[model samples]
Target: MCNFKLSSSPSSLLVSTTKNHFLISPQPSSSSSMDPQPHDDGLHRWPTPQEALEEIKAIGKISGPTAITGLLMYSRAMISMLFLGYLGELELAGGSLSIGFANITGYSVISGLAMGMEPICGQAYGSKQMRLLGLTLQRTVLLLLSTSVPISFIWLNMKRILLWFGQDQEIAAAAHTFILFSVPDLFFLSLLHPLRIYLRAQGITFPLALCSAGSLLLHVPLNFLLVGYFRLGISGVAMAMVWTNLNLCLLLCLFIYFSGVYRDSWVGPTSDCLGGWSSLLALAIPSCISVCLEWWWYELMIMLCGVLVNPRATIASMGILIQTTSLVYVFPSALSSGVSTRVGNELGAGRPARARKSMIVSLFCAAGLGVAAMLFATAMRHRWGRFFTGDEEILRLTAVALPIAGACELGNCPQTTGCGVLRGSARPRIGANINLGSFYLVGMPVAVVLGFGLQMGFAGLWLGLLAAQASCTVFMLRALTTTDWTLQAERAKQLTAATNNQSSPPYPPFDKQSKAAAAAKVASETFCSGDTARDGCSIEMEPFIIIVKN
Candidate 1:
């Protein structure tokens, strides 16, 4: 057995440099898998304040484009509410309710599962395990498409389900009409979302921003032509978005496959893609839970509003409030994605201190964005709703809800960023538990009590949101404070370097078959010297080197 260390503290392969060629065997990290052995070189220790600031600057470089991408995504989600609200109170209320339902049953699950790809791809890219990114993408695409089949049934029967949930019959009918044209949205998202994680992990975000902005710019005119002139009603609204998303997806694929920007990440579909089903599912299920719990809860608040007295006014108010908060939320969420990628990449490279510094910087960024959003909401509370509707009651109710939503952001932003830290660190189970406890165990009961028992209506539901966000923030902070960054870095190393939960020897014996021999031949390859900072380091028999990421 050969003892191979993963950290780049040494410049060359662990084996004797003088040897021309040799078969190398590597073992699992250690018997105590959860504890990382501390090194005295200071590479993995806590950072100084200046170092933290520098790390933040690096994270912001990536997050700037990421933030723009998120803003565009928010704009896409807002089309229904913004356009439909202008149609009539009935359309706004009905459209908002249906969109909320679609999110819960369809988009949330798909998006959550896509998050599993974050750690996988981020770690893969960081460690130079370029092949795994393709496998992760293929496996995720398979899972999402399979999952979408059952979710399609829910969208089909949405009208009846809303009626069973005690929604007003007219609102339910209008909601049904909107959902009827939304089926394609589910299928398109299943593909596009996983691709997002793959690209973000490789730090390829600007194209995403460009693609989304172009789609958004085209959508406005399409909305006008279809809904404004053709008078296609809600179906027109649904078609406008559906076609736009489809075009965006196609453009991204063409850019990736043809533009050479992502050439190394994707190698056409392979046999290995079909083999990692169970391993991928292990991370994916928890990731789905972690993200879906938070996303569904936010959407659930809108649904809860529909059952209250003066349902139209309350639902419309919640609609404006939900879209407004979502638009504001794009900032923190974008930072979260950036940090997840940065932390995972550093950890995969076995740089614990960098990952730790990334987390601290993200928390501070979230804090700053939260303050700006709160002030903006406070200033615009009376007028922002004018963009969505002319009704004074809806505008007033929306205004009443803005302050609370803004306050909620103060806590919500940090927790959201913290969740990203968890994802990048391959610790989604912790996030899932925190979300389950905060949103369902504590916050749901509080919401019901305030909303129904006390007749607080929209205000009561927001108070519940605040409670949940606060609880989540406290729990996530506690988790972050206790995290062993060294251990997380070690885990990242293991994930990117290991195969099937075990480290693969550099020269695993190959069968005599032509395919196996060809694979081994390809494996014995190299690029630039195995420098820690350069991505060229990879598996090779000539000056054989291996690197890992978190």
Candidate 2:
């Protein structure tokens, strides 16, 4: 009879077989583990063509489906809006107000706070700290659920708040009604955000795309059933919106159960998740602010338009242009999420060069996408407005603003992707500072001057955005250029190291003398193999870890 033994660590696994008194242990390839890539020439040198191509493929695999998934999710909101339109003008107006309010207060906050999990989950998976992934997910879900409570109270008082702000009584009451029905969405989103990040961190994307697409396909029919057939009115529209997120969450849960893809990382909920709030909140607050600062800027623009010379036309045209930018934003946003995962993974794996390469490749891709967006907006300028309206004044204003908005995209895409790089590097606070400085300090001043002081009107408001994007791009590029990939890799190691220590080791820790001996042996082997000159194979490499069984 033969005996078998198995052992694993972050980097590799050992499988042993024995017959009689003989034993053979085989190890997996280094490339398949957390081992650094062979090249350790540092981050300055450009990646070889093969490396660049591989990085592109990796990023594309995540970004392609991610882009589709984003569009599908965005379409859910569009469908809701369309159904509201079908209900009549009053319902449309009220629903639009409520949706916008929810976005600013509820959805944006949820999305931003959830981003705090990205770097942690990505790095945890990369470093093979599988338990940390589950812990992070659970902690994030708990955090978001807690956050939703206060937001719920805010939603509960929506009418009084809207009325206090001097909004029309009828519209405020309508908005309150719509918002009241949407409270359930806050809880659903709490679960959905962490779940998506948990999967995406592990290079799981197709399922997200698949699930989102399936949900969106059902969204329209569900809307019809509730609003048209049940005649639930605006309440039906709100409920349909809530139900879409709930459906997506359920689908994702079912998919995970059926596929068992989460088995490796998911240790199931545990008491370990109860702590670790501060670490997550540190990242989450800045991420939330960074996202909100950008989102609220556009909303601020809308408010500014309302006070313009021709309020109706300006606000209408602004709405159309905002929609145009939203459409253009989808690709860059996807690229951002993809790069964040890639960077975090490489860094966590202690492959600084590979992480740097991911950043470079993603930046170039974002630039290309930005240029394409600019050209598209420019090319479609004459006719793009017709999709939303045929009023000559609004159309003309939209046509003029479209190209400027496109120019903004030229800067927007790269900056957005750069933000992702920052997130992956666990430096969201830096991105937040940049946004706060650029948009509010620089862009806002420029807008006020151009729009009112110089009397450039609506176009001036867009030019302000152009100024903001340009400044933001400059700063983002500077940040990316100045990044210390080696330092980031060290940080990633530290971040996951704590969690690994908290976990039960598969085997006992090595004694001091044994660890020193093992280190010496590994160093000698690496040096003799002509890897001594490389940064990774030096004596200061990671401590040797192993598991053995008799």
* Local accuracy by lDDT, each model: 0.71, 0.77
lDDT per residue for candidate 2 within 159-249, as digits (tens), equals 9999999999888888999999999999999999899888788777777887898888888988999999999999999998888889899
- Residues 1-550 of candidate 1 have per-residue lDDT tens digits of 0000001112112343443212111111222222133343334455566667666655665677777877776777677557886678788768877877887788878888878777877777777777787778877888898898999888999999989978899999988988888888888988899887887787666667778898888888988998999998877888888888888898788767655545555657766666545445656777788777877787777668868988879977886787787777777887888888888877776667667778887888888888888899888999999987899989888888888888888888898888888888776767787888888998899999999999888889988988888888888888787766766665566555542222233433333454344433323321111212223322221111222321
Off by over 4 Å in 2: 1-39, 499-550
Model 1 clash pairs are 344-550, 347-550, 348-548, 348-549, 348-550, 349-549
Specify the highest-lDDT model's number: 2
Q: Could you tell me how far off, in angstroms, the CA of residue 207 lies in candidate 1 after the best superposition?
A: 1.0
Leading candidate by TM-score: 2
Off by over 4 Å in 1: 1-46, 85-93, 166-173, 228-230, 307-309, 386-396, 452-457, 497-550
Predict model 1's lDDT versus the native.
0.71
Model 2: number of clashes?
0
